[model samples]
Structure formats: structure tokens, C-alpha cells
Target: ETVIYRIYYYINRSGTGHLTLRELKRGNLIDAMLHCDEEEDINKVLRYFSYEHFYVIYCKFWELDTDHDFLIDKENLIRYGNHALTYRIVDRIFSQVPRKFTSKVEGNMGYEDFVYFILAEEDKSSEPSLEYWFKCIDLDGNGVLTRNEMQFFYEEQLHRMECMAQEPVLFEDILCQMIDMIKPQLVKTDYFTCLTIEISCLQDESYIMLRDLKGSKLSGSVFNILFNLNKFMAFETRDPFLIRQERENPTLTEWDRFAHREYIRLSMEDDVEDASNGSAEVWDESLEAPF
Candidate 1:
């Protein structure tokens, strides 16, 4: 029942309480499925059935599952992306505020849960990712992301920056930037007054609506700025090569890029480990006495 509902929810992207054939065909899913059936190699269907993507997801889980267990606890997940996510966000995830855990285990997240998390973490611009984060940030479950709620997450990020000896960006400055970028409808104010009012006052009058975030291309950056330090920094640096890649291959999702990069990194690490083991074996053989 859980799996069925999840599939239905995702397929019904329109949220009109109805799943249309048009929506199903939106991403060429049907065509991809047809090709996937025809081809002996499912990996060739990069959109959904790509083996590369599954390999990336599984590799991420394997790396985090240090005990070789099939599940990961909070500590394990914290190590993800070199601890890119803030503790507050991790807490929210463990709390299952964004989505309920399918795993029957008390505190550990299963592979399926990790897949949901990694996809959402990597691709915040997508509808499901945006929704995932919004629920996590909406700490009170009020459906709206209030200033206090946003700051609750950003506080740790600020502390992390200070601890790292980096010039910390104040929450006020970040709020201003978010307002400018998202331009969410102010509760009791207009855009003209926003410039004149103090940051503290603006907090009471401003809130981020889901639509506001969904409308912006930089929605992912908003979440990154709040909790994921590594990604947020990368966003600020604005790598021209990445920008060029996005322009060149607009069809590729953020998940695709992230998976590709991680796969290469993991493969290289495996090669290096193999080479090290081979050298160690050779050294041991040379040291062996004839008997």
C-alpha cells in the first residue's frame, strides 16, 4: 500500500487529484519504457532505467553503510557528501517530517529511503525535491516556511562557517537575497516597503510559499544556502564549466550530473584501492622465504 501510494503521488504531479496520461508522457516516460523493453541493456535508457543511476545510488549507500549493514543510522547519513547537510536538516530527515520511513527499523534508514533522500538532495529544482525540502523546512508543519523556521536551519550553517574560519554570511543578508531571488508574496507588505523596512520587521511580514520556490530556477540554491554548505559554496563560486554543461545538455537532470560525477569518483577510488592491494601482495611475496 505504501509503495502504491508513493507511485500514485509521484505520477500525479499535477496534484489535481487525477493522473492524466499527458502527465505520464510528460518526460517521455512511456517512450523510454518502450525503448527499455526493446533493448537488452536497460542502462541505455538514461532517463529512468539507467544502471549508472542505480549504481550511483547503491554506491552512495555502500559508502555510508560502514558496517556493511543494509541500513544507515544518523551518523552514517551525516557523513554523506562529506557532511554537506546541516544537523538541523538531518534531524528533520530522521524525524521523518519530510516523508515517513518505510523501514520498520527504529532509527535506521533503508536503501529505499536513502534513494529518496539522495535524489531530493541532489535535485532540489525538481517538483518532488522542492516539496521534500519545503516539508523539512516547514518545521511547524504549517505548510508555509516562516522566517523563524528558515533561520532555524540556517543557524547551524552560520555556526559551521564560523567554526571553519570562513567569513560567515549573516542571516539578514541571506534573507534579503532569498527575498530578491524568490520574490515571495509578503504577508502584510508590498515590494516597495521591503526596501525601507528593517530586516527584523520584514521577517514578520515575509514568508516563503511553495509556489514561490517552485517558480524559481534557484530554488535548489535556497535550500543549499540554508543547510548544505558544500553545495551552497559551489553555487556561489558559479563554475563556468558546469554552467556550460547545463546549457549544452539541458535534458540531463541534476541527479544525472551528480550520479555521473560520483560514479567516476567511486570507480577511481576502487582502482586505487586495487592497485594498493596488488603492490602490498607483491611486497609480501618478495619478503617470503623459500620453503
Candidate 2:
């Protein structure tokens, strides 16, 4: 029944409280089904219909839901993406700042919630993804990300870097880079003074509004630098091969790339475990043969 309801909910995208034939056709689901037999890769289809994508998402949730209760708590979510997220961001997520949880378990995330969280995390460049993180960073829910709010999130990242013995980047330096990257319309002045002099002492009342990020492609990188250390480092020391992949397949989305990578990783882990079990069987058989 839950599965049927989920299908109905996704199919009714118009949110007019009713499902229409036009909306169903707009999904292009029939076209996809007509071509499914011709394609070898299941993930090539859109996420809504892709079993491989669902497999990857479900496996990730299963790994995090260690108790097998089919619900994720703050600790479980904290372990997500190799702990790429900070506590503050996780708190914002639980607070339902971005979106309310469909799960009524109180402070826990269900599979549906996990689905939304994973999609937003993997594809920060998308409009919905942008909105999700934007709201998370907007502490006061004022629709703009103030300097203080951004700093609130980044302070944890700075402390994390220090704890790991990595060179800590000052918030002032990051603020300058962010301003330059997004190029938010601050009073036109020599912002480069931040580079030549101590920017910490200077008062630059710059705020990053949602429109600024919506106009820039580097918005995802900005969010990563603020909260997700793994992605930030990956962006800093970006792999040439991954860059080539992106260049080669411009049609594939960030979420698509992430799901593909995770699917291969999960499959490889399963194969390794099977191989280990096979080896154990061989050793046991040899012992029985007195060799």
C-alpha cells in the first residue's frame, strides 16, 4: 500500500490534488518504457524509473540504518557521505528547515526522507538542491545567507580541519573568495584589499542572496567549502578522470554520476565478500582431504 501511494504521489506532480493524463504523458514514462528494451543500462533511464538508482539509494540507507529499523536518526545521518556533513547542517535538516519529514517517527528520517536528502546532497547544482542547502544555511529563514550565518556553518569546518592537522583557512579569506566567486553586488570597491591586508579587521557587509547563487555555476562548490569537507577537498584536488567523464557526458547529472559510482562500489564490495566466502569453502574442503 505504501509503495502504491508513493507511486501515486510522484506521478501527481502538478499538486493540483488530482492526477491528469497530460501530466502522466509529460513524465515521458511511456516513451521510456518503449525504449527500455533497447538500452542495456537501467541507470540510463530517469531516476524515477531506474532500478539501479533505487538500489544505490536503498543500499546507502540500509548501511546507515544499522539497527534495520528502516529509520535514520541524527547519529546515523551524521555517518552519511563519510561524515562529510557537519553537526549544524544535520541539525538544520532535523529541524525541517529545508523540508518537513514525511516520517512521523519524531526526529527520525524515513526512506522517503532519505531519498530527498540523498538527491539534494548529490546534486547541489540542481534548482531543488540549491534551495535545500540555501534554506539550511539561512539560519534566520530570511531568504538570504548572511555572512554571520555562513560563518556559523564554516566554523565547524575550520575546527574540523584543525583537528585533522590540516591548514586552517580563515573565515575572512573564505568570505573574500566567496564574494569573488559569486560576485554578489556589494558596494563597488577594491575588495582585493582583503588579499593584501588583514580582512578580519575590515567590515564588509556582504550577503549572498538565492538569486546570486542561481546565476552562478560555482554555487555547489561554495556550499561544499562551507559544510562538506570531502566534496570540498575533492573539488580542490579534482580528479582529471572525473572531469573527463563530466566533459564526455554532459547529459549525465551530478546525481546520476554519484549513483553510478556508488552502485559500482556496492557491487564490488558484494563480490569481495562472496570471494572470501568461496575461499573459505575451498580451504575447508582441502582440510577434509587431508592436504
Candidate 3:
């Protein structure tokens, strides 16, 4: 780690021993590492840096910054979408987790906060990213999610599902689905009742919750995707402007893997359809025309 740090210090070029968010946005991290002394190829560890991932993230931050203030306010996000998906994204982003205080408004996010948010959103299984989300969802900053906070987002989703469904889906059914995925140890439902969500997915209710898990977090992005994900499928329909997940080695998140599996599934489906169609055509034209 020390050797890598030394190499990174020189690669920083700013002589500050740290790579600023601006430095990342401007160009690729590996490109900078390549310029390092040719004697040792520091770029070998490029996979560890997530050079491309950070670039995409920086670009996204720039896009959403809108006013160029290097920050995103709730107004800007709400304008991003008035729908349930947007509401949940906004809710999680502005959760009561403590920050350095970039905005006085209820839920504004600066670049640093945005970076973690994107990371967790991109990779649900990441322990670190999960923790970042947990902080946001833990509105009371009590290290656990309360009923009010969870319902605030769930209710919006309920209204949304209702509009899209041919039939009404009770909150309990949704909870059951969510419980299967999130598997919150203590199942508290009744819609109006305060909900307490432990971050872990353990089946045992008496077991330790996610908050108690070392380096644990629960981001809204992951929850939204998981809640709607059907087996290996989860469409990122919530955020139209959501940043594309970078596929660099070691950077592939659970979502990425799932998407890849889904892609294979689709490809197989297409192949089967084409084969069936070809067989039908062959049978139909079993006898050639007079020519």
C-alpha cells in the first residue's frame, strides 16, 4: 500500500498527494499512471483504481450540477423527475446522514456525497457503497432506519405500482416481496405503523441487523432495483439520467453481473425465436416453385 501510495503521489502531479475530483473529471486515471517512469509499470494495478468508473461518475456529477456550483440541490433533483423513482432517489440522497453541510436545504448533495451515492447505486453488493447508502437512509442518524423514513419512499412506490398495474397490489404483498429480497430481520408492516429496517438480509429475526454489521450500508438505488428485480432482471427505469455503470475489471458490481446474465438470457431468447421461425419457413416452402 505504501509503494502504491508513493506512486500515486507522483502520479497526482498536483503535488498535493491527493487526486482532486476535478483531476478525475478532466481525464482518465490510467492515462496519468502510464506517464509514470517506464521502469515500473504502475498501470498494472489500474483495475484497482476504477479509472473509467470514476470518469463516468465525474461526468455525471458535472451533468447534474446544472448551475456549475459542483453541487446538486433537491430542486434540481426533483426536477430530474417528479415520479416515484425520482422521489426515492432524492429521498435516499438527502437522508439525514451527517455531512460537511454543503446545503442548508433538506437534501442537497455535493460531489463527494454524489460519488458514494453513484458507487452504491451501481454496485449493490459492495460493502462500502452499502454503508454510504445506509447513512443516507438512516434519516435519524440513529444508525438504523425508522418506519417513517422507509414508508416515505415505499408509499411513493405504492402509488407508482398502482398506476402501472392492471390490478391493485396491496402494501403487504410488496412488503412480502421486499422481505424476500431485503429479508429485514424484524418484519414490521401495517403501512401506517413505523417500520424499522435492519440492513442485513438474514432470515433469523433475532440475529444482528445490518447497522450492526461492520462496514454496512443500504442505499435506495440498490433497494429500488432489488425491489423490482425479477430473478436476474432489474431495469434501471427510475433515473433516466442515471450514470452508466463502468465495466472495468474488479469494478463490475452485482447489478452489472445481473445485467450480463439478463443479456445472455435475451440473446438465447432471440436465437430460439429465430430458429423456430426458420423451421416454419422451411416447412412452408417445402416444395420449390416451378422455377
Q: Which candidate is the best by TM-score?
A: 1
Order of candidates by TM-score, top first? Answer: 1, 2, 3
How do the residues 89-116 of candidate 1 rate in per-residue lDDT, one tens digit apiece? 9989999987778688989887767877
Q: How accurate is candidate 2 locally (lDDT)?
A: 0.77
Residues 1-291, model 3: lDDT tens digits: 322332332244453547877756654555545544342543233333423333344545555667766568766655431222346646556663523344554456766555445445556555554565556555566445544555555565556556667244455554444444454544444222434433432233322234443323323333553232221123423333223443243465563443344446555755887878755223224422111
| TM-scores, each model vs. reference | 0.81, 0.79, 0.49
Model 3 TM: 0.49
* TM-score preference between candidates 1 and 2, better one: 1
Q: How displaced is residue 201 in candidate 1, in Å?
A: 10
Clashing pairs in 2: none
TM-score of 1: 0.81
- Best prediction by lDDT: 1
lDDT of 2 by residue, 102-180 (tens): 7999989987778778878998887667888999998877666778889999999999999999898899999888888
Give the runs in model 2 whose Cα sits over 4 Å from its true position.
1-41, 185-205, 278-291
